[model samples]
Target: MANHNDRSGEIVLAEDKAVMAKAAEWLREGRGVALSTVTRTWGSSPRPPGSLMAMNDQGRFIGSVSGGCIEEELIDRYRQGELADTLPLSLGFGVDNQEAGRLGLPCGGRLQITVEHLNSVTSIDQLLNRIDHGELVARQVDLGNGEVRLLTGDGHPELSVSDQSLTKVFGSAWQLLLIGDGQLARYLARMARMLDYRVTICDPRETFTDPDPLPDVDYTRQMPDDAVRNIAARPRTAVVTLAHDPKQDDMALLEALESNAFYIGALGSTRSAAKRHDRLAKMGCSPQQLERIRGPAGVSIGSKRPPEIALSIMAEITATRNRTAGVAAT
Candidate 1:
C-alpha cells in the first residue's frame, strides 16, 4: 500500500508477496523476525489497511507500513526487547494532533498496527508456497496465544482484525488475455506486466512474429478462440481483442463474453465497432453480452501513438478493477 501512483491492484499484491517472502527468508536464516501489519487507518494515512512491514533482530527490515517515523519506533522497540514478552501486540499511532505530527502522519491521520513475532520457518515457508501456487488462502493469527493457521479463503473479504484474532487474505495475481500480436499488443503486455498482471497473447496468424518477447508473458500460435476457451474466465481476468481482423477478434470476443471475465474490450474506430457489433448480433450474441464490450478499448485520451494508447487502456482497466475491489478514492 505504499504510494503506487496510478498502478493497478496487482502491483500492491505483488509487494505483499515480496515482503512476506523476505520475512520467510529471514526466519529460515535463524534470525528473529517480527511482522507488522496495518490493521486500520484513518484520515490521510500514507498506507492503507493490510500494508505490511518485516524486521529482523539485526535491525534489518523490508517493506513499509507507513512513510515515516512509525517504522523507526517499532524497530527500536523490537531491538530493546520491549516487544519480547508480547507475542502479538497491537499498537495505535497518531491518535491526537500532537501525536500525529510526532509520528509524521499527514493531517490528523491515525493507524492501528498489529505486530507478531514469527518463530517458525516451516510455517512461513508453507504459507509462501501456497501463495506461489495461486491458492486463495487466509492466514489467521490468534492474538492471545500467538497461534497461526492457514485456511482456504473465499477470496472476497478484505483484511480484518478483531480483539482476539487477525485475518488476512492472499490470492493469485490478476490475469490479462490479449488476442493479438502487434506493436500495440506488445506495449500493452509490457505495461500490464509491470502492473503485476500475468499476461498471455494468443494469435494464430503464421505471419505474426514477436518483435520483443517478454520473459514473463506467454505467447501462443493457437487460434484465439480456442486459447480463450482454454484460459476460461475468472473474476480477476480481463480479455482484450486488438487483432482488428474480424475472423480473429470476433472469434475471441465471442468466447470471452461467455466467460466470467470482468472486462471485455475491442479496439476499433466508431464505424468499425458498430459493424463488429452488428456482426456479433447476427451471430446470436445476447444484448446483455454485447453491452459488456467496451468499443475502442480505452478511455477517450485522444492518444494516437501505441504507447499512449496502451497507457489509456491500462488507466481505464485500473479504474475499473479498483471499483470492483471496493477501494475508496483518495
Candidate 2:
C-alpha cells in the first residue's frame, strides 16, 4: 500500500493541484515550468485515466502518468528545452496492438497527453483554490489549440462546445454517498473526508439530531430512497448504507444496486445479513441483485468496535476502488 503522504501516482486532483501550485510558485521564483496531463487513455495503461504531472525547468518533477514509462523522457524534454511551445502536444507510449507484446504493454495501451507551458495567467492557482473549497469544476482544455477555460458546474461535461475538439474535467478524485447518522457514520464521514471523498449523509429520521457533532459531513434529512434517487451515481462514486433498519437500508440499497456506483455495501452481521437478504428476497429482489449487496461490509478483520469497524469499511471501499482501477488499467 502506498503511504497517503506519498503523492506519486495518486489518483487525486490535489496531488496534481499541489504540483501545479508549487510549479507556479517556482515560476514566480524565476523558474520556467511545464505541466503535462493524461487526458485520455486506452487499454492497460498505468495510473488513472486522467492523471497529471508537472516539471520545472530546473528538472524538478512531481506526479506521474505511467509506471515510469514516459517520466524519463519528459524530464529530458525539460532539461534540453525541447518543449518550448505553449500549445498542447500529444505523445504515444508502448506500441500498436499488433506489436504490443514486444514493447512490454501486454494490452498495447496508448495515451494522449497534453503538456502546457505555465505562466502567471495560465496557471491553475484559482482553479485549485476552488477545488480546495469543495467545488466541482469542469476545465475545458482545447487540445487542438492549447487554451484552458474553467467553469463551475456539478462536475459533469456538457455537450461538445465545438466540433472536432477535446475537453477535460480536473478536480477531486471521487464522491462518497453515505446513508445513516449514527456514531459509526460520523466516524466514516470524517475518515472519508480525510481521504478527499466528498461525503453526504442521508437520514430522514434524524436519529443523530445534533449537527455540531458532524461538521464535515453534508447533513440531509431526506429519506434514504429519496436521497439516493436525487443523485446519479457515477463510476467514481461509492454508496454505503450504515443504518441497520431494513426500511432504511433496503430502499437505499435497491436504488444504489441499480446504479453505476463503484462500491455498494451495507452494514450487518452474519445472521443479521442473512435476514437482510431474506427480507430483500421476499421483497422481490432477484438472487443476482441480492448478491450485489455487500453485507457485513468490510474485510474480515474481526473489528467489533465502531471506529475500527468504520476503518475496516473504509479500507474495503478503498481496496475495491484500487482493484477496479487496476482492472481498468489492464
Q: What is the C-alpha lDDT of each candidate?
A: 0.81, 0.71
Q: How far does residue 181 in candidate 2 sit from its true spot (Å)?
A: 1.7
Model 2, range 1-330, lDDT digits (tens) per residue? 122232333232336566667776777778787877775667777765557677777676677766555766787876797888777666666546665554454566677666777765444777778778856677666766777778764534422233334444556567788888878988898999888787898888844585466666677788887787766355567888988788998989888877767788889888999998888888888998888777889888877999999999999999987665441111
* Candidate 1 lDDT tens digits, 8-127: 112233277677787888787888999998988888888878788888888777777777657778888899999896579988987467766775567677888999999888877778
Highest TM-score model number: 1
**TM values, all candidates:** 0.82, 0.64
lDDT of 2: 0.71
